[model samples]
Target: MPSSLSIAAFAAPLIQLAAAHGYVSGVTVNGGSWVDGSNPNWYYQPEGTAPDTPGWKALNQDNGFVSPDAYDTNDIACHKSATPGETYITASAGDTLTLYWNTWPDTHHGPVLNYLAECSGECTAATADGLSFTKISEAGLLSGSNPGTWATDTLIANNFTADVIIPGSLAAGNYVLRHEIIALHSAASANGAQSYPQCLNIQVGGSGSTALPAGEPATDFYSSADPGILFSLYTAFTSYTIPGPDVWTA
Candidate 1:
């Protein structure tokens, strides 16, 4: 039998594990639901529910996955081994896309960022290391009146869902939208910030032929010592520095 101290130690990690988990369940493009597990044709097919199975995409399993202590590595891009050959969801360039998560912990307060990568050829064959992403949208701690933290931002706080508008002026083509959440509750410690990123295959439809601006690699997003990821959020603060490339406007 485990001793009282042993039991407490074992329970502590479980508590932490439960607090840090979450995943995007569905992507809504142009009013259609592309549920991850339900529609394998539009999204990567999760290898039945277990992360250890063959064809299981690493980041999709949010049981206890987190990333590098800093932006020194490319793992920040897609979390882990991403599912390839996913069918791209079709949408208009200006449409508003919604990303729905299973559930976000109320305590995990931080910014939400959305990115887009125009595929050079076929998105199904694209790999995380080969794709270049443009910051399309990012929301940080809100200011004014009552003031708002990213955790308390609009529908994201209440519904675990956030929306970003597709750039209307963007040229139509195949692309991947990456929606991410940075949980900073334990960020004061080294490697404490949890970055959850989900990439969705997409095909944009528009007559515009504007070229996307230059962007940075996911590995370039942060450093282990970056103040944003190593700072405390439990005190009085006015603003926040989102730890990625600037949002690109075409």
Candidate 2:
């Protein structure tokens, strides 16, 4: 009887979800100056409604506030004010945070709008750092299978919220929230100027581990342009050296 034989197959693609997780916090813009065509002083307006009064009045209400002066000559001056408890979610390693903001026609401009979560250290209040902003999510901007970029001239309308995903491998610690609108144009002119709105602040917390899996080995075959199996009846063996892992110690 022939000897018992067995073979094992170990060639399969490794698939994974990457262990990246994320969350979202809602933000509310309120309590700013409203430019209605009435009361010259700043007044208050209801949520989600423009000031009904006339003559460019400043609305002190949290929801419907407008600025008195047009920051840019080409663009109309508007105000954006967010509340204290705007951000509500926290994040950790293998996780993300998606910030939801109320949309308006004039809110969507080309600027680096960011949402950052702190893991250990405190988040910076300065607009220079501590935020992660991306272009508005439009179609056909991104090449791969992901959300695209914001379309030029695409204003932030109602029910339109941008998704700010925190990196999956971020460390765990306390986090603060803020936003900035870099003025695209200095003043309103025929050249189409833009102005950025003030940033708001909020706080959150997170805790978790961020460990990654080990690497696997790769296989390859040897090949030569030889016809005869027996040449000098000699076989030579060769070996290769792979670099070792460079570990970092905290």
Q: How close is each model in CA RMSD to the real structure?
A: 8.5, 24.8
lDDT per residue (tens digit) for residues 1-250 in model 1: 2333442343343345465446655556665754441111223445454322111144433344445553555567766656543566677878987665655567777788888888789787778787788999887677632223574355444455688798998898888787788878777788888887777777789887777775767877777677767757776666677888788877
TM-score of each: 0.79, 0.32
Clashes within 3 Å, all models in order: 1, 41
Q: Candidate 1 — which residues are off by over 4 angstroms?
A: 1-20, 37-56, 59-62, 144-148, 151-155
Error of 2 at 9 (Å): 61
